[model samples]
Structures are given as C-alpha cells and as structure tokens.
Target: MNINKYTKTDLYKIANNLLWTWDFEVRELFKKIDSEKWETTVNNPIKLLDEIDETEVVKLFNDNDFLSLFEKVNHKLDDYLKNKSWYAKNLNTEKDLKIAYFSAEFGLTECIRIYSGGLGVLSGDHLKSASDLGLPLVGVGLLYSNGYFQQKLDKDGWQNEFYIIEDFNKLPIELQLDENKKPIIVKIKIADEIISIQVWKLIIGRIELYLLDTDIKPNSKKNREITETLYGGDIETRI
Candidate 1:
C-alpha cells in the first residue's frame, strides 16, 4: 500500500481495530474521515483505508480536528483492551474449559452475508454479546461461497433466487494461519472418505469465530460443494 509513512502511527492500529464495533468513538472517527467511502465499503475501516487516497489520508493525519479525535479514540481502545473485567478477576470457571457454539448460520453484517433468516441474525448477536461479556466462547459454522440467495419477484409474482458470490480475499476475514505462516488445514473422515477443511477466522470483539470451508482443493467434487450455499439442497444435504 506504500503506506509506510503512516503505518508506524497509532492511527493505523485504531483504524484496523474491528473491535470498533463495540466502541462508538472509534467508529465515528472512521465515518467522519470519509462518510461516503465508509458507507460504500460497508463500514469496513481496513478496506476504506486501503482504497482511500493516500494524499487525503495524509491530510487527515495532519488535521488538528482529526488528530484530536484520533488520539481520544486510540486511548479508548487501549483502555478497553487492557481493562481487566469483573469476569476475569472474579469468575472462576475451569481453567481449561472453553465454550463452543455451533450454529447453522451467522448474520454478523451484510458485508459478509453467510446467513439466512432470523436464526442466523440471532446466532450472530449471541456471539457478539458473549464477546462483550468476556466469555471464553468459540463459534463453529460452515463458510458458504454463495451465502444466502437474494430474492426477487418475477412478472407473475413468483420469486426468483440469485446468489452473489463474494471475494473472501478482499473482505475483512483472515485465514487462520499456523506457525509456518501457512493456512491451517484440518482433516476429518466423512462416511468412508477423508475430507479436508480450511479454517477461516472472524474476530467478534475479543472472541474468535472459526468457520470451516470444505471447498478446498483436497476435497472431491461432491465434497467441495458441501459448503456452497446455506439452506441448500434436500434432506440428505441437510444431514
């Protein structure tokens, strides 16, 4: 990005903190910086920064109003990250105990539309709330290439379904990487065949949500389509 000039600044860190979902000030700063781009990019600060003009960003960095708000928001984020919650100091759950939450879908935001209906939205809210409460929670779900189908009415009032395949690389998602800096591959047996699943990580505040993708190269054609769409196919597919 040739942003080394501003990469060393704490402003970069603040802009990259997706945890701004939980903070109003930080979210406002990004929006204020460029409301038009913010809306176009689905409130994704990282993408907004990436696509925004570097000259404009440099001007914002030098602006006194932007600098003032940036400092305040940055401090707020630092405090939030360091603050030891009551759950941390008082709650005594088993040290090795970890909570695993599984859901058919999650509607975290419209930008990443891997959800359908209210159940998905509810599941996403649960994960967000759990993270806010500082619970040791993990979410498991399948990553659909074509999330939920978009519905449109035909001339005769029949519903037409269309799917929008999103480019995951451009999205804010991060592929779970191992010590060797390669994607962590997980293998499991399904029926009599061994299938490989690639894990993708999404950050929901302090919590980590892991999604399994069966569309990797190691899987068979049929197996690769397992994670193609949400609520797709017949009862066998559901099973």
Candidate 2:
C-alpha cells in the first residue's frame, strides 16, 4: 500500500467518491490527467490515480487551474453530502420510513460489471431513477469478483466469453469502515452455520448502494466462492 509521496492531500478520496460517477465534469478532470489509462481502466479514478506516473500527478497538483477545479468539486461534494434535498424537506410520510431494494445483480455502470442481463439493467435504472427523485432507497446486492462474462465474436463469428477479474480496491466502491477506519464485518446465520460478509458501499448520487461480499479470508473456501461469478452455479447454489 505504498502510495506516491505526491498524493499528500485527499486526492484519492475525491477521486474514489461515487459522486464523480454521475458528475461528468469531475470525471472528465480525472480523465484529462490520463486519458489513455482512463479508457483502459473503464474510467476508474482510483486506478488512474494509482497507475498514473508520479511526475504527472505532481504536475497536476501544482497546476492552478486543476487545483481550482478540484477545490470547487470537493466543496460541492461536501455540500451535497451534508445538505438535505427536496425529498427530505417536503416529506409528509413517516421520517423513519426507508426503502430497501434487493436484487440478484445490479448494473450501476458497465465499468463495475456486477450484472448479467436485463434484470440487472432494470434494477440499475430503478436505482438511478430513485436517486434523481431523491428517494430514501438503499440497494443490497452481492459483489462479484468475475462479473458476467463479456461476449466477443471470434474470427469465425462464433461467440467467445471473457471473464474479467476485478480488483475492488481499484474501483470507486468503498469498504464500510468503522470509527477506527477498519473494515466493518457483519455476521449472519445461513441454514445452521454462521457466515461473515464484508460490506462495500457505492454512493449512487443521493442514494447509497451496499454490496455484500463473501470473498474475505475469514470465510470458508466454499463460502468465499459465493460471490465469485454471476449466475454461475446450480439451482440450489443460486437459491
């Protein structure tokens, strides 16, 4: 975890924040720094920051225009997180009412490919629409390591499948951290045995999407593979 010395500020935080996923301007700022790598990594800011040359980041840090834009974007994010929206201000129902959305897969974006088909696409659209409407929605889903296989046409026009192994650390998602900045682990009972699930958070504009991953070291090998692929098991396993 040796970060470059030049990243002294909260540059990683601002870049990894899911706000940039929706804000094209802020996303473009990161892309401007490294366009080639940006496209290669599916516009992943965390990956961009990690892989970009140290000298390039240093130059951007010293650039007044980049700094100005960075500060403004950070300020706007602070406001967005702290302030209440129209939905909160004008709500007439119970204040404690909350919506919990559950789906087998969610297609938030193609970059974070935890989706397989139309169901995930529809679920993603629902969350996006919910965010736009300022609804009190929380999404729950499993984090897949190798998301749905990417389809490609071979030279003979036959179908070829390519599965991508995603490095979660390089994505915009964040591990739910406790007061001491350690990952918060949640334990639950399934069947007759207990299992541990690590929670990862993805901020979808106004809403927060939480994905549970069973790929931690504490889990058994069988359990660790639960989140390995999308729709990749038998009927019982799928259930």
Candidate 3:
C-alpha cells in the first residue's frame, strides 16, 4: 500500500514512537481505529496502521471527534518532548552525564518481545523509568530476529514452541546510517573470526536504546544467526 499519503497524519507519528506504549489516550486512539486488529497485533500501532483499510483511513481522517482526540494526544506528546524534566531543572553542570545500560533482552512491549523472563521485564522497566525521569541514559541490547518463542498447546494438551521471525521494517525501529547513507556497521574479532555488527536504534520517549545485530551479509551463516534467537542454542551462541 502507498502509506506515504498517511505519513503526515498524527497516527504515524504516535505509532513510530514508543511513547504510545505508556500513553493510554494514544492506545485508546489506536483501539478506536480497530479494536480487533489492535488486540491481534498485541497493541502494536505500526502493524495496525498497515492492516487498516483505506476506507477506514479516509473515514477517520474526516472524523471531527477522531481529529480532536488526535490533536489532544499529539499536543501532549509535543509538550512532553519540548518541556524540561526534573533532571534538566535541578542538575545544572557544564558537562552532561550519560549512562549506558546493557542487557541480554528488553521487554519494552508485547509487540517487540525480545525478552524471555523477569530480567527482560526489569530491564525494560528500567528504560521506561529512565525516560520518565528524564535521565541521560542509553540502553544497549541484542536484536533477536526471532526473539522469544511463542507457546502453543496440542489437542492432547501438549506444549509446543514456535519462533516468529520479526520484520524489523514493520517494527518501530530505525537502522543506524552513516554520513554516506550506508548502514553503520562495526566489526570486532570473536575468536579466530571477525564478526560484523549492524546497529539499530529504538527510541523510548526521550531516551535512546541501541540494539546490536550480527545478522548481516558480511558475517558467516553461523555468525549471522548469532542474533537470530533469544536465550537459544549452546553456550557458544551466547558468546
């Protein structure tokens, strides 16, 4: 579909940012568009936008009530981004302090489920809390192509595991680019072989989270799959 025509809408703005994750009104706005799609996508606004029909899009655009709510939520997000927070007001120093937090997985939202358990949840919460607090913090984590496994049950009540490969293009993340407009890649030697890593950026409110990925053409098949799964494979994969 030609989504460019709708890019100027506030819906796209809200969908691209994780701020909608915490903003109830934004979530409600999305649900207002299509409740079934919202639930099926696990409250993912990006996917919802893609699935919504053009007729619905046109109808919503012409809707006065929808426009009013969109304006309200958009303004709120604007104010949040432009206004100074506690850290900015109280901490006045010549040099700005920045912190980098590293974790194996981050459970930011259900749609972007790279997290496996409590640790991922805690890490995700930390990033959200940091964003809310207006701290100059950056999160570092791995971008698993398949992320975690989805649970299923057989007719006999047996448990089954399935991995869903995520399309990063559909997700709320941007690839890091260099001055040449090429993807910014870093290389590091792991044992006898050198691994090339591509960087992806995930924005959380005012905070920035950088995710590392080994899934690229420069790397070998085995190395490319290094970031394919979360908490999967042997200890060698963990490294």
Per-model TM against the reference: 0.86, 0.84, 0.93
Clashing pairs in 2: none
Model 1 TM: 0.86
Error of 2 at 103 (Å): 1.4
Candidate 1, residue 17: lDDT: 45
What does candidate 3 score on TM? 0.93
lDDT of 3 by residue, 74-110 (tens): 8888888889877788774635688899999998999
Candidate 1: tens digits of C-alpha lDDT, residues 44-91:
776777776767877787777877787788777777667775567677
Give one clash count per candidate, in the order shown. Answer: 0, 0, 0
Best by lDDT: 3
**Residue 111 displacement in candidate 1 (angstroms):** 0.8
- After superposition, the stretches of candidate 2 with alpha carbons farther than 4 Å from their true spots are 1-8, 177-183
Off by over 4 Å in 3: 1-9
